[model samples]
Each structure stands twice: as C-alpha cells, then as structure tokens.
Target: MKSLLVVSIVFVLIIIQGTTIGGTRFPTSDENSNEEYTYVEYEEEESSEESTLPPIPTTTSRVILSTELETEGPTIANEFECPTNCKCNKKITLVDCSHQNLMQIPKNLPQSTVYLNLSHNSLKTLNVNDLINCGELRQLYLNNNEIGKIVNTEDFAKLPNLHHIDLSTNAFKPLQGKEFSKARGLLTLILTDNKDIVTSNVPIIQTEKLKTLYLANCSINQLPENIFQNLSSLVALNLDNNPLNLTQGVSAFKPLTELRRLFIPTVPRHIALNLCKNLQVIDIINLSLENHDISCFLLFNNATYEESTIRTDLFKTPTDPPSNSSIVVSTTAPTLSTHIQKGTEVLKQYANAAANQAKTTYEKMSMMYMILSGLVVVLLVAILSVFCIIGSRQLGREISYRKQNYRKYSAGNVTVENPNYERYLIECEKRQFTNE
Candidate 1:
C-alpha cells in the first residue's frame, strides 16, 4: 500500500510536470502558459452554450439604386487610361492632364469633368470625335498647341452646355460656314494669335449670344463690311494687331453701334472721324493717318498720328469743339485756318507797328544824312585848297625849269639849243598874238 501510494504520487507529479514544463527543443514562458490555458475553459463553456442556443433572426434593407444610375449616366474617370502624373479625383470630378507630351487627344475623359485643360501639348489637330463623350464639359483650354484647323464643327455643336472656349496660339485657320453657329450657348470665343485666320464678316450668324470675341493678332487685313451686322449683342471686339485696312468705309464697324470698347491697332482717318458717333472707348496704339481730318477724334490715350497732310477743311466748320480728353495730333500736319488766321492778324499788327517805327527811323536817318552831306562838302573844300597849293608848287617847278633853259641859252653854253630856244620864243609869241 506504501508503494501504491508512492506510485500514485509519482503519476500525479508526472502529469503536473508535463503540463508546466515544455520540451527542451521548444521554449515556453510563464506568461504564455497562463494565457494559453486560461481561455480554454471559457471557450469550451461558450461552445456548449452556442450549440444549445437557437439562431437569432435577422433582416436586411433593400438596396436602393440612385436615379442617376437608372438613366444613361455620365462617364467616370477611372474607365479611361489616364496619362502619368495625372489623377482623376472623384470628389472634385477633375482630370488634370495638362503639359503632358500627349500626341493624341485623351479618350474616355469623364463626362462629369466640367473643366478640361489640354494646353501645352503636342496635339496637331483637335479630333472632336474623341471628345464626343464629354457632354458635361463647359470650359475647355486648348491654348499653346499646333492645332492648325477646325475640321469638324459638329463635335463642338453637340456640346450644349459649352460657354467658353480658348483656342489662343493654336494657329487656327479661317472658320467657314456655320462652324460655330450651332453653339447657341457660347458666349466667349478666344482665337487670338492664330496667324493664318482670316474671318469673313463677323461670324455673327450664330454669335448672337456671344458677348466677347477676341481676334487679336489673327492676321485679319480687312473686316467684312457687314461684320458687326451679326454681332448686335457684342459689347467688346478686340482686333488689336490685326492688319485692318479701315479705308473701305466707316460703315465697316457701323453695325457695332452698341460696342463700348474697340481694340484696333490703327483707326483709319475716316473711321476715326466717324468713330465719335459709335465707340466710347477706342484703343488705337499704333494709329496712322493719310490725312489729319481725324485729329479731332484722337482725344484718347496712346493716340498717335503719323506724318500726314492736314485737310484744309479740318476744324473749318467749328462744329466739332475740342474736348477735355487728350488729343495727340501729329505736329507734321499743316496748321489749321484758325491758327493761320490768328497768326496773320498778330503778324499784321506787328508789321504795322514795325512800319511806324521804320518811319521814325527814316526821319532820323534823313536829318543825319543832311548833317553828313554838309560835313562832306566842307571836307571837299579843304581838299580843293590842298590841291590848289600842290598845283602852285608844280607851276613854280616848271617856271624854274624854264628859267634854267633861258639861262643856258643866254650864256651861249648851248649853241645847238639856241635855235630850239628861238623856235620856242616864236611859238610863245604866236600864242600871245592868237590870244590878243
């Protein structure tokens, strides 16, 4: 019974050792042992309870789809392969793929994208077909590209919500029949720096809703006579740097009666003359004129007039009075009649005063001349006295010469001269006889 008791005690010790001690190859800690054995009792109890308990009843809400999903909805950005360094943010619905070396237009752009900037790219032409999906696009920036011409107008016409389009520096050519007429909602069209673009008449047929048209540096030599006929709603028309020859008539811009601001490099003399009746604000920095008839109209800033002849009729009517505005008429033109008349009147007054002064001077000069003549007469009398004295001296020298000759003849020292002396005496006697 002692051995049995001892054996039972040893078996209990072995069981305890087996539970507490790990194998030499495997490591275990006191904290790990406590953690591993403590959850076993609770897990077993929970498992028993779960097996006995009935399953709780549950219900789910029916999935309600959005109304946008029901209809043909707008396209999302992730559907397309967007370029590098560009992200399509769903919250803002913006796709910024600008300044990328994209040769072709990006396809599958989100229809929800309201603003699209494809500027500073290598796009040669605008493929409108690629943008048929962007129905929600309102503002598009296509500046700083090599797009030559707009081949398809239908693509732009389909965008009903499009209002502003910037095609500056794209080298676009002249637009043709109703290309932009279908864009009924378009208000602003920027086509500046398109060197080869020559617009025929203002594209006013469809631009009734357009408020601003920028054609700066578009190489337009002449605006069509009826250009402003269609742009009745236009408030501002920028034609700066365009080679507009306004000599055609002032009526070229006659249709722009409501235009508040006109941007032109030069306003033709005739146009400038008539522009006072039309435009309120005229910006003509490089104005040149063949005639100065329009000098009265150049009462604006930066107004320059090249060397030109002034019309005689300029300011002749006096109907157009000078205003408070600045007038930069070139000094090269002929003076106005009013200026000449004023100058002549002043000069005539000066000449009359000068003639009176001259009359006084002449009277003084005449008295001085009489005094000088008296002095001259006295000097002549003194000179004549000196001349008479010289003449007397010369007569004395001749008398001395004659006395010497007579002495020589009387002394008989000149036997050959005796006959000559006698001949001279006979000649003197004949002269005295003739005188008697």
Candidate 2:
C-alpha cells in the first residue's frame, strides 16, 4: 500500500512538471527547488460547429506563446491557408502580405511559394528562422518595412535558390563579414535608401556569380578597394547619390573588369577619363564640371581604348533564336556605344548653340551693311544736287551776257522807212563803213 502511494505521488509530480509556464512561474522538470506549486490542466470539448467543417491536413505544427496566458492559441501548420486580409493566387503561392499594419511576420505561408512580397509594413526586425521553410522562394521583397536588423545569417543562407533580395528603405546599419555568403546563387541585391550603411558594414560578398548590386542613397562615403575582387561576374554596379569622391578612390573599380554599367557620383576630369574607359553606361549623379570643362570632358570620350566584354545569357529561351545571336549579344558590350551616344548628345548641344550664334551674327552684319549702303546713297545724291546748282548759275550768267550784246547791236542799227529803201541804205552804209 505505501509503494502504491509513492508511485501515485511521483506520477502527479511528473504531470505538474510537464505543464509550461503560462502566467505563473513553475518548477522545471529537472530543477530541484524547495517551493511547491499547485498545477491544473483544462481540456476544451470539440464544438459541433467546427466538427461539421471539412478537416485540413497539417504538415508541421509549431506552438506560439503569447504574453497573455488566459487561453492557449491554435496550432500553426505547414499547410496553412492564406490570411483573411492578404491576397494569394489560386495555387496558394505568391502571397502579398503587405500594408496590413503588421508588427510580426505572418504565419502559415504556403511552402510552394516562389515569391513573397512583404513590403510596406511596420515590422521592426526580421529573424531568418521565420523564413526557413521557404526554400523554393526566389525573390523576397521586404522594402519600406521599418526593419532595423536581421538576426541569424544561417537562416538566409538556407535558401539556395533565392536570387533577388530588396531591403531598401529600411534602418539597417553596416553589415558583418560575408553577411550573405551562403547565398551563392544570388544574382542581384538591392539595399537602396538605407542611409546608415557604411563600407565596412557591406558584407564581404563572396559570390562569384553576383551580377548586379545597388547601394544608392546609402550614405556610403567610400568603398574598400578589394570589396569587388571576388565578384567576377558582376555586370552592373549602381552607386548613385553616394559621396564617393572618385578622384581619391579610382582604384575601387580596378577588379571589376567584367563590369559593363556603372552609376557614380561627381567624377573629376582626370578620373572620369580613366574610369569611363571600360564602362558601357555611366549615369553620373551630380556633375560638378564647369561649362567649358563639360565640352572638354565630352571631347575626351573620342579617345579609343580597349573595352571590357560581357557574358551571354546562358538560360535558354522559349523559342530558339539564331545560332550566333547569343554569342554576338554577349560579347557586344555597350562600352563604346554609350560613350559615343553621350558625347554625341553633348556635341550636338554645342553645335546647335554655335549654329544659332552664327545665324545671329549674320543677321547683325546684314543690318550694318544695309545702314552703310543707305549712307553712301545719301552722300551721292547730295553731291549731284550741288553740281546741278552750280551749272544752273553758270547758264544764267551766260544768258545775261548774250542779252546785253544783242541790245547794243540793236541800238546801233538804224530804223528804215521803206523795206526796199532800208535794205538799200543798210547795204550802202555797210559798204561805206567797210571801205573807210
């Protein structure tokens, strides 16, 4: 009878220890504490209303502990359905759990999800464990969430197939070493608009296949020289709006021989000439050159140099393109093309201005010539008027002299009484005067 009572007491102690601490503190199973506490267990009967509904299969179950211990919450399973407020596709994949004013990550996302968009939320932090089950996820959009830190790098590395990750508009500080070293297959990583980023915080990115990296508006002052040494496959690197004074840090791009497109800050004349040698597209953010220097800078692009080559798209297309098309596409880097286009634009602007100025000068010269021609015509007309006045005075004098001579000759002549007698008298007088 005593042995039976002892066994019953031990069994009761086991049950008491098995109960988890909900609101009140309880002794652990192995802990040897002198304090004794009373324990109680309550089981709820299945409601007939819930039983009438069809049963849902569960693949995995996790217990969620809440601060309030009033009642135990329901079990979360792997085959969890979409949340009431969120939208999902018919195949139960591609969940859009954004703008829900959620403070925590949503539970029970479908395992077959390829894309998960959780942008524009009020989340403060992220744990890798929350996303461990999403192995097939390729793109994860977590931009505009107030996430300050991401704990557990291992959880992120578990997703081998994840290619694109957007963590823009967050509150992240500098990252640690190889922050995403496990994401070997990652192709693109965007961390734009996180103003607290520092160069050291940029993880030692070890991915050889990483192609594009965007760090715009991250307050990055400078980049470590060797930060991109391992990224042999990188094609595009956007550092727009950062304060990287390229004059002091041109070596930052020495290792990026395969890089095709680059977006940088204000580039000095010497630096721009050298830096733009290999790049296809250079989207400069804040240009600080003078107007005269702008012409000089653009003219420098005419200098020819060796250009870097690019890789072709290995992923096969749905329809077969031409045989040599892929090879031609890969090797054709726009390095020279972009420079020619940009230089052409700058030169074209200057050409248009020069043409307009020439037109204006021609118009001014035409007006001056017209004024001079008018003056010359006025001078010629004044000289001709003066000569005509002098000639008219001379002619008047000659007429007066001729009139006097004619009057004297008429007075000397005698008047005849008869026409025949006057003629005989004039002839006799003229003959006598001539003989005298």
Highest TM-score against the true fold, candidate? 2
Error of 2 at 28 (Å): 54
TM-score to native of every candidate shown? 0.45, 0.47
* Per-residue C-alpha lDDT of model 2 across residues 102-203, encoded as one tens digit per residue: 787877556776666677789888876788777877667776788888777777777877777767778886665466777776767777778766555244
The 10-residue segment with the lowest total lDDT in model 2: 55-64
Clashing residue pairs in candidate 2, if any?
174-201, 175-201
Which sections of candidate 2 miss by over 4 Å? 1-80, 200-204, 277-436
TM-score for candidate 2, please give it: 0.47
Provide the overall lDDT of each model, using Cα atoms, as 2-decimal numbers.
0.53, 0.54
Please give the RMSD to the true structure for each candidate, in Å: 43.4, 30.1
Error of 1 at 288 (Å): 13
Query: Tens-digit lDDT track for model 1 on 346-431?
Result: 44555689999999999999999999999999999999999999999999898666654462433345433434566667878999
